[model samples]
Target: MSIEHDAHASGRPAITEGGPSLPQERRLVTAIPGPRSQEMFARKRSAVPPGIGTTLPVFVTHAGGGVVVDADGNSLIDFGSGIAVTTVGNAAPRVVERVRRQVGDFTHTCFMVTPYESYVEVCEKLNALTPGDHEKRSFLVNSGAEAVENAVKVARHATGRQAVVVFDHGYHGRTLLTMTLTAKNMPYKQGFGPYAPEVYRMPMAYPFRWPGGAENCAAEALAQVTDAIDKQIGAHNVAAIVIEPIQGEGGFIEPARGFLPGLLEYARANGIVFVADEVQTGFARTGHLFACEDEGLVPDIICTAKGIAGGLPLAAVTGRAELLDAVHVGGLGGTYGGNPLACEAALAVLETIEADGLVERARRIGDLMLPRLRALAERFDVVGDVRGRGAMTAIELVVPGSAEPDAAVTGEVARRCHAEGLLVLTAGTYGNVLRFLPPLSISDALVDEGLSILEKAISSV
Candidate 1:
């Protein structure tokens, strides 16, 4: 019944940078997937694994700013950002320029074998930009999952402990170790059992679905986590407590105000490391360089990716020096961990974020979206809740009279949006949330048009 805002999530309007020269417009030239995409889908059915799924199989030939152009010539307004991977926009001018140059110079020479200055420079930037002013260290990896796994390894190595704690509705990743850390079941953890050991789950302060009500969510959720950690895992046994500042695949859920700080306090009080998995929330997606900066909640380790490198596959684990240093010299690394092309792309992403003032742009996006979604909620009873910070917003769909999730309706609305040439993504644990992650480079005109299409889609449904 109570609604609060993060004061840090508002600012002056932003002047976004230019990225991807593709014309930004929505034009549905054919049926949703189009014939070319259909052909590709048929090929995929024969060639690819069933486990690998897709939201819209439009067969993208080009993407930039706010539009993803399909092979059939349809230009769909993009609100998904390739699952929030292209925050600076796909084929961002800076990224393309840097990577094109880097590719000609050299591609891979793995950081471990030869090492590169770009890699070291990236670590320096991460150490400086991530939360906390303490002496920090950073190492690059290939994906968010790898960053999280490295964070866990660093925590365990530093604390000399065995157990790790995660929260309900939190999504880490799909790797064996991260799969064990994740809380979801069906798609992520169902048959992939015989999971790794020593990971515990805590209740997240998810206000909308908390047991009693939103008001009690913060206090109760905090108590439950501490109690569970103390009684079940024993405080001393916990090496790290990992959580997303804002849950992404598990439905962009932003925990109540007091919960994160409370958890951080407990972690510090015990000798347990606190890891902030900022994969989806980092890089100005949440109106701040890091989501933890909103509450001033500094974690011992922060995992970043998705938006870190425009569209490159790069991730990082930045943390207190002692923890990262605790890992043996060769304890952490991968064949493609800090590939030079990715490193160049990451540096370009950082430059683009700072130059474009994307943090302010994300704030402007939230200012534009939250009010519109809230107004839509008032018009439609199926809109159970509208929550998110900055451009990373979501609307939780529900049965008309109650909080029961309406995943069916969510799917239908998404399908409608696709048919109308609007690219949107559905998320949440129950799969009833529609999350929007527009590239910050997108013009306000495109954002308005996308929202209009979404409104029409919801109305039609």
Candidate 2:
């Protein structure tokens, strides 16, 4: 059921006279995981596997703006937009309208079995909206990992090389190939090996945790990467260099300046394709449409998903025409790869972003979040570092007077927030980075209030 708005907000949600609307306020009416949620969770414990994790055990009944109303009737302030999937907000008016119409018209014909105009139009949109202006082509998939795997296929097919380079602290996805591409070991890749072959790991230019110093991160990391490729794998044998412009699951780690451009130059010189895995940082979630745009990067291939379709499962691999076209017919696709409903949702999402100036909105979110978090850093000894851009901001928690991560404290802080009706998330190699991804539809008042809750949570912890 699509909820209508009061029509008075800045994001300008589609208004209707009467409906059960989501109020943009944080209200706690019961315990975090109150009786009703506990009942559902007990059933989940019996039916669901332990492998599937839950960030907050509170089951949601409805969500919109900056609020997620759980089964217990608790309205929690949303700082995590369903892991950055709902950039336009959950049940967005545009997405709801388009998807509802698409569902009525046709659910699925399978793009491969029967062609559709929406798929072709989405590809065209990807070509125009992505960082490159070069002639390009795109194919859709069901998730980010699938898009990445296809991108690698395109790279290998075009270049006739097998070696693919990935960075430390990078996360591609959970599928077999992408799990192998991911850097974390415990949750994502522990028992999933023997992993994909010919995938190499490179040191990230993570300024805060860089070995030598922040100032030397760019040059040294680039040098180390080039040296690693030349000696370990041989540049001529490499097919693609894949990276997250701003490392997502890896602590929102923004590489130091000059690192990405240097890598691109090296790849171009070495005949290797550059693939930017913009799964989390694309679609105006970052201040720019793509985070790579911050450095004027033009990747040979770019993958996007998270915020693409306003919560629908959709991902795309957009790259140079020569590369994607190099694959033989039927090399890339899935049954639900550009499902009409998801395609319509993606189109509507793009429309919302452009119309609402979400790119600027993302910048404003960053402007609102970074300062408050930095202020927290000043006052709290547990805060090791504060970083991120646009709506994707986070703080690294560490033991006072040392760089060692305080995962225990991080967990406690997150628990405190959840208990108080504020939904937050944790990440990082050490599990100490507290991340925030407020919806672009979130109001200034909600953002301020959420940050207040965050501050209180941190202080109490």
Candidate 3:
């Protein structure tokens, strides 16, 4: 079929002529490096780095659906999903076609100078899709970090507050402000030094290790936060309480059910902006389009990225119209924040999510995987806790009953999983948690296959 015809069918303009799709049956003909990817990696290693390139012999010749075909022509089930950036799938047909068309027409005009319909359309979609019955607005950005930074800026600008409240084990981004907001210091904040001022950390309820167990964990955590916001950094002086509905990078820890609501209530009472850092948990990764939707506690601002543009770099802040509008005009944008290509891809991603029912797919992926992970936890002494929402699931590894993390074994498990033809990623302050970001478009068979491999890896570990 012609590209134009396919685009027309998919409700997008055509750009490139017919692009190829991967074969249905996965074929791993050679060792992962095969021959091609190794060559690319060697060439890249001289350019990339040992620190940057964690997965060695890394190069993908082709990827689609839930599998990555490496340069060696080895088809591996992709569970990391490009670090939760490709929820729909790698090279999703709709996203590819839309991006192609957009690139062909015009790539960058920089929304700051000459605005485009795609940017406006994406903002409109975000405003509509984001939780809340109140009037909403959106600001598009390049990456999750940028989105988060801008969200903080908006909150501070609106509330005229100097202090920001973040939770323990929370991760915002790598930027100055975001790094300050991030709880972990090593690597991200270590020597990165002199982080932005006024960023304070509070404890969060990790049911697995909360002093009072799940029953009083939420209340205890809430009391601690309320006290901090009320006494130390008066809520009046605090611009926002940034939180991840399901904490990412901090070990896929889901805040207790009432914890989020409690924080929101505190924010509402003190006129504090509640910022939901849905960077990793947004776009149906948590099964509800936005993880915040699970609690029905609408934040003053919602920072989103990762899966926003199907694979392209796109991030956004969606929230109350008044607060978002509070920022001075032109005070909240980047040169390539909402590039047309990214905007087109994002639109297609939203459509594909709706048309293809990917949110349901995420819920299904979670339903299928969680039980097995729970079972694994029961068997493994190091498996401290298995928790997460929807497709954004993780398993925290600890030393038996204690909260002491086992980063060594966690690293080993991840290494084994990768070697066994399954790509996985680890998170947490101690890096003892294995996070699963499988594509929502993944098939039941692929899910089962990946889990079986994971089971073997964990068993070996």
Candidate 4:
């Protein structure tokens, strides 16, 4: 049989922001919710819990560089990157090999009981790599929420304080404390209340909705934070102020220029431990290694996860040695905190990032995605704001001429894209933002292909 190839096709370019090229041309030969996937879904709806089924309804069978192949055999260009969990790329060769080797040797020894070299190595790397040249220490955990909780523990222990401050629209995790830290209330936090006490909510810099320039927005938010701390919850009682440098679940809400600097100053003056939650923005997803680096702000504590181990469940809190040491022995640790297999994967992930120049690649990908998204925003009145850093980005949807969100239309666009074989994620407190998390290693052609599908979806909207 003769093989067919596209005229525009070239050999898969290394470190491309272009898009993905399969070994062969991509062909969606069946309906998106193909027979196989539908059958599986039927069986899943019967056997699996109600919460397990996908909101998009397409059941993925396999995923690689920049595409997801569903059980129905429909090939889709992946723009969500598994919700930013596969930044280096799905099934990265290095991470896969490391996992295989580690699993063969040992899966878990429970680092808390029997420490391993890989765990210490991963922590050492984190301590050295995280911002702040000053002596630092690291503690590993099983998930982002766990990492955030532990950061709070360390801050409280160091400061002998109880209150923690978080901003609106920031997402932490599903666990009790993190759910409380998270901003949105409906699904994640609804009916799960009587949450951990001493947690306070503050306003984040949302320039698109805020009526002013970047400087003015920052000033307003800073003033609000000051008053909140003074009247509602005094800074003297606060342990830490946790923030997402670029608010992830908060509609990719980027803190106004100088806003982060002002928060740092306030934290310093008030003796508050400033925690930068980079779980969604770390590991070069924001062009720089960490979003905080953009402002040269050295957070007292930093929480990271999601993309650290390629895809494995791993999270960490890296902070000043003195602060971390303040926690009593046995204060921070989990049974699978630094599993050997996950640590091995993490090591490989760091290596792949450096060797592949993914940090720089993320920035280039951002440069490419921004213009296309901005163009869409310009054309569509529903497209309210396009914002983000590096490859981490989003397009907020709104009703024409009003800041009022248009989640219904955003959801419709995503549903349409799924039918057209593109995978994207919806975010924001109101669920009105479409965030993009394409793999850093994706090719330009694939990027354009996905964008074309997106353009078509928006046009239909």
**Candidate 4 RMSD to the real structure:** 4.0
lDDT (tens digit, per residue) of candidate 2 on 329-360: 88888799999999999998898787666788
At residue 81, candidate 2 shows an lDDT of 94
Q: By the lDDT metric, which is better: model 2 or model 4? A: 2
**Which residue pairs clash in candidate 1?**
none
Each candidate: RMSD to true structure?
Answer: 4.3, 2.4, 4.3, 4.0
What lDDT, from 0 to 1, does candidate 3 have? 0.83
Model 1: residues >4 Å from true position, as ranges?
1-19
Best by TM-score: 2
Writing each residue's lDDT as its tens digit, candidate 4 over 1-461 gives: 00012311342435333323343224486887888888888988899898553766777877777787887677888888877888888777788889999899989989888888998898899988888898999988989889998999999999999999999889999899999999898778879889999999998888887766555899998899889898998989999999999988778899899889998999999999999999999998999989899999999999999999988999999999989999888877978888898899999888877877778777777877899999998899999899988888899999999889999999999998888888889989999999998887677667788888999999998
Off by over 4 Å in 3: 1-20, 24-27, 49-51
Give the per-residue Cα lDDT of candidate 2 at 364: 78
Candidate that beats the other on lDDT, 3 or 4, i.e. the better one: 4
- Could you estimate the TM-score for every candidate? 0.96, 0.96, 0.93, 0.94
Pull out the clashing pairs in model 4: 18-443, 18-444, 18-445, 19-443, 19-444, 19-446, 19-447
Candidate 3 lDDT over 1-461, as tens digits, reads 01132332232222223323564334668766567876787788789766564553668877776788876778888888888998887888888889888878988988888899999999999988898889999978999999989888888899888788998999888898899889998778888888899988999888887988988889998998898778887778988888999888888998887999988988899888899999999998988999988988788889999999988999999989899887787787878899899999999989878866677767777888999999998898889899987898999899887879999999999888877788888899888999999887666667788899888998897
- Which residue pairs overlap in candidate 2's backbone? none
Q: In order, what lDDT does every prediction score?
A: 0.88, 0.90, 0.83, 0.85
Whose TM-score is higher: candidate 1's or candidate 3's? 1
Q: Alpha-carbon error at 391 in model 3, in Å?
A: 0.8
Q: Per-residue lDDT for 1-461 in model 1, tens only?
A: 00012322432223234345577678888998999999999999999999999888889999877788999999989898888899887888788889999999998888889988999999999999998899999999999999999999899888889899998888999999999988889899999899999988888899999987999998999998899888988999999999999999999998999889988998899998999999999999999989999999989999999999988899999999988887888999999998899999999989878766778888888888999999999999999999999999999999999999999999999999888898899998999999999888776777888889889988998
TM for candidate 4 is 0.94
Which candidate achieves the best lDDT against the true structure?
Answer: 2
